[model samples]
Target: MANSPSSKKRARQAERRTEVNKARRSRIRTFLRKVEEAITGGDQAAAAEALKSAQPEVMRGVTKGVLHKNTASRKISRLSSRVKAMGA
Candidate 1:
């Protein structure tokens, strides 16, 4: 469907970017899952640590255009709240 050379090149680039973004998203999810597992296991310290570690990764995702800033902020807020509640 890409008749123009530029369009064909763009299609190719999109395919490659899709793979990269998918991998990045998957890695972000894995980090989030670690925090979730820590929280679910009732380990406040581990959950806090995981949240700390995940914060930068999530923010980096936003900076890299892999995620929205508000979305990342919401996730961080919720996770930290859950971690805080775990201590109480």
Candidate 2:
């Protein structure tokens, strides 16, 4: 219960931010899932392309504060390595 007017305003702002962050997180997951599917499907080219597209989305999640920078970097690193390994 937000009794103070300022606190109420903050609560409203938080609700809006929550919706935006949720959408961003969902979009990032969708991109990641696409990369995973491509990789698992064993199409090297498609997986590489998916990873290329997912990299920026993952980084955007970091910038938007939904994901940690290190977490995003690690995910990108692992996915890239997998994509690279698929070529071998």
Candidate 3:
């Protein structure tokens, strides 16, 4: 389908980028899931710690364009709030 040399190169590059982005997104989700499990298990301290580590990873995703800034911020906000509620 990509007959021109430049187009062919672009297609290859796109494939590589897709794989990288998929891995990055999956990694971010794993961090988020850890926080969620900690919260759901009612371990406030663990949830707090998990959120501490996950926040930066989520933000890193935003910086890398894997997620939007607002989405990352909302996720961090919701997770922290849940952690706080667990404390109370």
In candidate 2, the residue pairs with backbone N, CA or C atoms under 3 Å apart (3 or more residues apart, or in different chains) clash, namely: none
Positional deviation of 39 in candidate 1, in angstroms? 0.5
lDDT of 1: 0.95
- Candidate 2 whole-model C-alpha lDDT, 0 to 1: 0.96
Looking at model 2, which ten-residue stretch has the lowest summed lDDT? 47-56
lDDT of 1 by residue, 23-81 (tens): 99999999999999999998999999999999999999999899999999999999999
**For candidate 2, lDDT tens digit of each residue in 24-83?**
999999999999999999999999999999999999999999999999999999999999
lDDT of 3: 0.94
lDDT of 1 at 25: 95
Q: Distance from true position, residue 14, model 1, in Å?
A: 0.4
Compose the digit string of candidate 3's lDDT tens values, residues 1-88: 9999999999999999999999999999999999999988989999999999999999999988999999999999988988999877
Q: Kindly give the stretch of ten consecutive residues in candidate 3 with the minimal lDDT sum.
A: 79-88
> Rank by TM-score, descending?
2, 1, 3
> For each candidate, what TM-score against the reference?
0.97, 0.98, 0.97
